[model samples]
Target: MLYYATTGALPIPSGKPQYQQPSYYTSGDSTYSVSPPEDLDASVSSASGVASYGNSYSVTTSYAGSSQGEYDSTGSASGVDLNEYMQERFAATFDPLPLDKCTAKQAQTSGHLNAKHRELLELQAKAQARLAKTRARFAQGLEDAREVRNDLEWTQKKVASLKAKASKKHSKEYTKARERYPSPDMY
Candidate 1:
């Protein structure tokens, strides 16, 4: 539905200044030239629209009679050029509007999520610390159990040695007493 045309050279009609379309829209460095058609009326609206950077310029041609071209040019929306009208409207309507900020609800929701994430991280750290402490305590308990078992073994060995010595001494005393005292029948 949109058509874009580009040509190398276009002839300008005799006895009138030619109107040209700009090449670049952003920089405004492109030149605007016009070649009025031969059959075109004298009151025809020029293609050169109002353009402004620092200063404003209007290139619309004035017509004498109330011709069709003159009537069309003098229409209600025709007083100011399209580009000028758009620029003015944009400046008036768009320039004053401020940028929107995050709403209170959104801020609160995000804060809650952040707090929850931090809480989860803290809990994980605590769990790991507790697990390490439990492991350390378990190892300590195992060491204590091993120490108690070794003490019990040492006590058992000492008691066995004392029992063997007491048995030997009591046997010797019994033998000496029997040799020293005779039986009643023998006496």
Candidate 2:
């Protein structure tokens, strides 16, 4: 009699075989069936008796079909050869130059320095051009200021000469004007 602890029920005695034949195990989308050899029962019993005395036991299994089919089928489902595709991708991205670590580092550093040198040269040229342009503008401004100062000085001198002529009392033109329009106070 077999007792089920969880169900708390005892199975009734029946005249049937103790072991059932091997059956299929179903998983998602796949079914697997395993059949034991004719003498597996005897071998397992003997193996179990040996294992009871603290001995190691191992089991080996071999499939009938070629294992390569699994990999080939998976690759074909994606429309490409997996091995070839991986090789091509690896080759495309792999860098094969400068095998030595020190040489690779030196090459990378030199390349960076060369790029920086070119950028510095370009910046220096631009700065020099800007300095030249600013100097030219400054010189032109100074020249214009000098011209304006000279013109202002010339105008001041001309105004002073005209004032000197108009203020003179004994000039011939002034005496003639005085006589032609005799003063009314003198009468």
Candidate 3:
């Protein structure tokens, strides 16, 4: 609701009809009336329409006391009428429940347990924690396994070449390596 002011500022006072009423301001005639809504506290100020909520919001229009953009809201029912309707509807629709007919067995089972149950509950909690920690570690992953497998294959090939060269009488260092490191797979 953006209002465009054609002549000047909107809401020219009703008492000062010269600013709002076309007849009073330009045409030189005099006739005006204020019409309020069923749910509004409305009035007129020098031919300007004045409508407002209790004190929260307000709207005024100045176009011969009947602007197309003006709006009024004023409808509220009292509290007593609403309360009576709700009570009557509830009595007709609702029924009460009976809790007075229980047997001896029902009364005895509602009692609390002794100390042994509490100890068992604590033991169950510890078992669950241990299981959770094991699952978390296993979930860390398998990349290290793949790396170790690759290293083992490379070391095996290196050892086989060293053993082949060690058969040569002049290769004394290969013999020393075989004694010192054993084999990568053994470790």
Candidate 4:
């Protein structure tokens, strides 16, 4: 939250939760009680008359004695409580696997082939790498096939035109070209 401080050099400490006394230094001759904002809101909301301050305006907040901000968090539970709850949930979520691996078996009892497990894991990793490489090569092969197919079709059309042109002429070069470019029946 951004605080708009209207006074000289206010202390908004983040290092700790508790504070001894968050006192206000007034240059005038008035001092205000350190009441919680919600409490003041409640009081002001239920008021029959308006209250006024002369020189300095005060909106006070307090948490009982040294345990400041203990019950003053955004919600009913504080940050520390929330962190502990999350840690417990994390531990509970993953604490009960089968303990099949060597390190996990070592953590429990010692009755598993640790070396074979490691070897199998290494083999699985190698197999996965090979599979990924094969897929990439397969995609490249498809791209190359597309280019090859387009070139083949274009070359076939050009040769077909040449074959037709060669049949219309009786020159030696045209005869050689007509024979050099075989007809589709040859395939």
Candidate 5:
């Protein structure tokens, strides 16, 4: 009553500051501190031309048929044959070996011993098998590389689509999303 009479307000008790959970982001063994959405501004943005948190975030809507034409879909099983490109690129230095043929010349002479003929044929067969296996492995590596390239391309397209959707001008949701957010140029 006295405090209220003198200051025209009741006495207020001070309490300890409440503990807050720190916000951060993780990316492949790295961590970054994140500010509150309202506190975000020019500082949080990345200068490497890549989108970071804060100004980078906005209302992102899915656009239909976004994935279509992101990559070539020829409807054929063979799409963007990397092997053809590789052959053209490296054909000069790394030429494919000719298949080794097993002939009578490789076998024993003077009434051709049966054991020697069998041994010669077996060696030839083994050599051919090794060559075939190596070729198959090379083909598999090329396929794996192609898959990685496609996946990267798809991811990039998806990110780009999201950025475009978020930054689109004549949209109700975009305006609403920017209610408390800063200018789109910050993004």
Candidate 6:
């Protein structure tokens, strides 16, 4: 039977193995009795006294059921200790690792490794940033060089066109002058 401490209600036994109901439950320094239902024809009588523990009291209850005449003093109907059964069921299965396996030196080494990893990541980021800047500068310089080359080609073409025009314009004048001032070899 489960006892509710807050509501002080007696819960009907459900699927649990046959065990004698707890007479009383202790909380802090007070003891509260859990009386059986009236329909069960049971009478509960409790005696309370100060326990060995400081300021705490204990209760001893006598249950007289009509069918059983008197409750089992062992608090178990089948002679099995519930506490021992629970302890066996909930016992730890494995041993904990020794403290020596996790030393302060190992923790310090782990911290140092983590710091170095962070440093490496930061350095890689800086290097990538520098590489990106270098690539951008290289691309800009190539564009500038292309523009300069186009300008130089245009200037050269213009100069060649001007030279051709000047030579064609001066050709007739040069012929007339040469005819007027004949060479001594011709005389």
Ranking by TM-score: 1, 6, 2, 4, 5, 3
Candidate 3, residue 149: lDDT: 89
Residues 130-175, candidate 4, lDDT per residue (tens digit)? Answer: 9999999999999999999999999989988976777677678766
TM-score on alpha carbons, each prediction: 0.41, 0.36, 0.24, 0.33, 0.26, 0.39
Superposed model 3: Cα runs more than 4 Å off: 1-121, 137-149, 165-187
Which residue pairs overlap in candidate 5's backbone? none
Winning candidate number (TM-score): 1
Q: What are the clash counts of all predictions, listed in order?
A: 6, 0, 8, 0, 0, 0
Q: lDDT per model, in order?
A: 0.54, 0.54, 0.47, 0.53, 0.51, 0.57
Residue 140 alpha-carbon offset, candidate 5, angstroms: 2.4
- Please write out the lDDT profile of model 1 over residues 80-169, one tens digit for every residue: 454567678887887332333446667889999999999999999999999999999999999999999999999989987975776587
lDDT of 3 by residue, 1-187 (tens): 2122233333535352332322222123543332222232234222234443232222223454454543222221332343456778987786543333344445544433435567779999999999898787766546667788899999989987876867585467766876787876687
Model 2 accuracy (lDDT, Cα): 0.54
Q: List the residue pairs that clash in candidate 1.
A: 18-34, 19-33, 19-34, 19-35, 20-33, 20-34
Location of the lowest summed lDDT over 10 successive residues in candidate 6:
49-58
Task: State which candidate, 5 or 6, has the greater TM-score.
Answer: 6
lDDT of 5 at 147: 100
For model 4, state the Cα shift of residue 149 in Å. Answer: 1.7
**C-alpha RMSD (angstroms) for model 6:** 16.0
**Pairs that collide, model 2:** none
Pick the lDDT winner. Answer: 6
User: What TM-score does model 1 achieve against the real structure?
Assistant: 0.41
Q: In model 1, how large is the Cα lDDT of residue 61? A: 39
